[model samples]
Target: MTASGALDAPAASRPMPSLAAFTQRLRDRLIMQEDPATAAYDRIMRRLGISIGIAGIIVGGVELPEVAEQGRYAPAWWTVAAVVLAFGWYPIIAVVSAVSGPRAIRFVCGCAAMSFLGALASIPFGLKLHTVDATTVWPFRVTALAVTAAVLAWTSRVTVVYLLTAATSAALATVYTVSAVTPQHVTENFLRSAGLAALFVWCGTAATGAAARVDRESAIASRRAASQAAAHSRDRERARFAALIHDAVLSTLLEASRAGTKSDVLQRQAERTLEQLDECRGAQRDPDLLDARSAVLFLRAAVHEINPSIRFATRTWPGYDDLRMPVHSASTIAAALTEAVRNSLRHAAVPGREVRRTVTATVSAGSIRIVFTDDGAGFDLAAVSADRLGISMSILGRMRQLAGGSAFVESQRGEGTTVTLVWGGDGSR
Candidate 1:
């Protein structure tokens, strides 16, 4: 399907949105809500995280027992240690709560703190809980696994949290399970968690890499399209201007010169014709109208060549310099709209002995807007899928290559069609 038809089809079969979409949305919203001043928020978070980490180490040593053993029991100091952990954790939680972006950073912080504290407190792991039910520690294990999985899911970063959390959970679960502690189901769990975490990391990374590649390819395609269009327009302009010189000024001057019988009179007329030709040519050749004028000159010259009675009116497009857009962006906008004009002119009916066709070009911020309203009867743009596709794909496709910009056509029988094209962020000479 052409780019246009591709745009008009049903929406049900679209691919699932990418994980990158999550981060993009987060960042966009963050920028919108807090603006760039939120950079200070990140700095403050980092400082708080660091301070919290230092406090954990100091309090862990002070409140927890000096000796450590895991298999037999809980420490007399477990409550005191939990109290200290709660105090230190609150500041980091507050930082995370205020953060306006991807919670991947917060997840990492929480996981690291949980894993470190859980493992170290295991210094007295076996000291208490002589006969505990396996189901009792189940939540702890599950929470550990979930948090580790979440970190892997969100950030795709490899960390010791996975091993530390997994090990602690499995250890506690194994100690309490009624069976002979067969590695069968328990080992399977370890392998399963590892596998899931690995898959998430791989998928996230692969998706991110693919997205970047697509973006680069799109950018390259846009540049090439613009360059080809610009080159084509330039060539078309020269052809039309050459034709104009040949017909009006060049032919008149040549004919006058050939009539030497009225030599002085003819010579004066020839000189006047030559001067007029130069002035007209200079106006047509103004670089500001290079591509826009190309379309006008080419359309008018070609139509007139076919039939003198056919009148084509074209107004020179405004200079793009005022927009100050980047070159590729400008080129894409100009090229797409130029092609649309060509298509509109080509599609119009030419049955009459006398025909009047009008084409106008408008340039606005980073967009080359063109409307070719003609006297010819117009077709239902929506009904004609092929022609509609031509506009969307040829025109809109060009715009899409410019950061997914848009192109559309509005038409009515006996009225006319209007084609709109928009290019991204910048479009200027």
Candidate 2:
């Protein structure tokens, strides 16, 4: 954590975090703070509901009618069963459609439930069981099938599920029609049934695919809205940090300079610390920068709405997040880096006695380091005040907060000043 070599290890050093881990962490944080048992129950209940919807579809659509009507002695209970499902299926399954994960599950289940119920209602010549007149029972079947298709299309937002349920529904309908005509036209019915199933599959496939595409677009729009909200929060935190620097630290530094008690080195260091603090979004903001001793490569694109200019020119950086430093250690290191960058920009002299000035950042071994060097005249190092707020409140103060780390300055006349920040390192990459 404190060395440069440890932080900038090559990619082969250790395995990177996986997609599973990222999603798992997200699940943990967004848990809605419910009791463990309550959450488990909710998840299970939703799954059960989905299962019931699917089961009702199969029983009503295919199994019940085939078993009851195929035998010469049809049961009166079968007609009663179909009618029961026709009226109740849609509203009962509607409760399960509210399940959240994947968002498509409930929709698919609901559509399937309605289609199955429709199949039940369509049992032809059902009056043969003496349950009702053939005319009355016939209308129930047609109306039920149409209602199920319409319900499936209207309720399930997922296109794939809609098409699948619809295709299955249509296949059931065509096959039933061919099978039920009073005088069995067995060969003609078989060919017509097969052809109808194939045609319905194609039509449903196209229509359902279109619906799925529309759902995908809706998801993208929602993500964009969430990102904008996070950016606003970061801006507010930055403003709060800036206020602390201006009101408390800057005022004291100015007073020290006026009293003629502060050394030249102290004044210069104070100016530098201010620069780093200015760039900071501070502790509460998701890390703008971190210690590199863990030698990690984080793709900035994954983080929502980070500064475009704030980036890694170097491929590898030290890691000190949940993977390494405990909460306290990471925070201490964050503060140190902020001050190091601040001091460098304020007071670094030009290197090689030239006038061009630039700040370069690099992480190596167990340290995430930034060097602010310039081609300006440098001053004596020993004459600087150790107690200067910039040095005491910023650099050394930050290092002292960390368990094992240090901040160092190296400078020479007519050369430049370089600030080095070091942190504790781990054996792993």
Highest lDDT model number:
1
Look at candidate 2 and tell me the lDDT of residue 387. 35
> What's the lDDT for all of these models?
0.45, 0.42
Q: What is the Å distance of residue 339 in model 2 from its true position?
A: 38
Find the 10 residues in a row with the least total lDDT in model 2.
1-10
- lDDT string for model 1 (1-429, tens) is 011111122231233156743543333232222211133343333334444445444544543332232222445475345344333453444344334332444664555546444643443343333243232232232333333333322434443455445555555554453234454756665665556645544543454445446546645655564455456655766776778677766777677667757666667767776776686666453233334443333334433433445344433335543332344455555555545454445454334322244444444433444444444434454544342334555566667777536666665544445565544343332
List where candidate 2 sits over 4 angstroms from the true fold. 1-76, 94-429
Q: Give candidate 2's whole-model lDDT.
A: 0.42
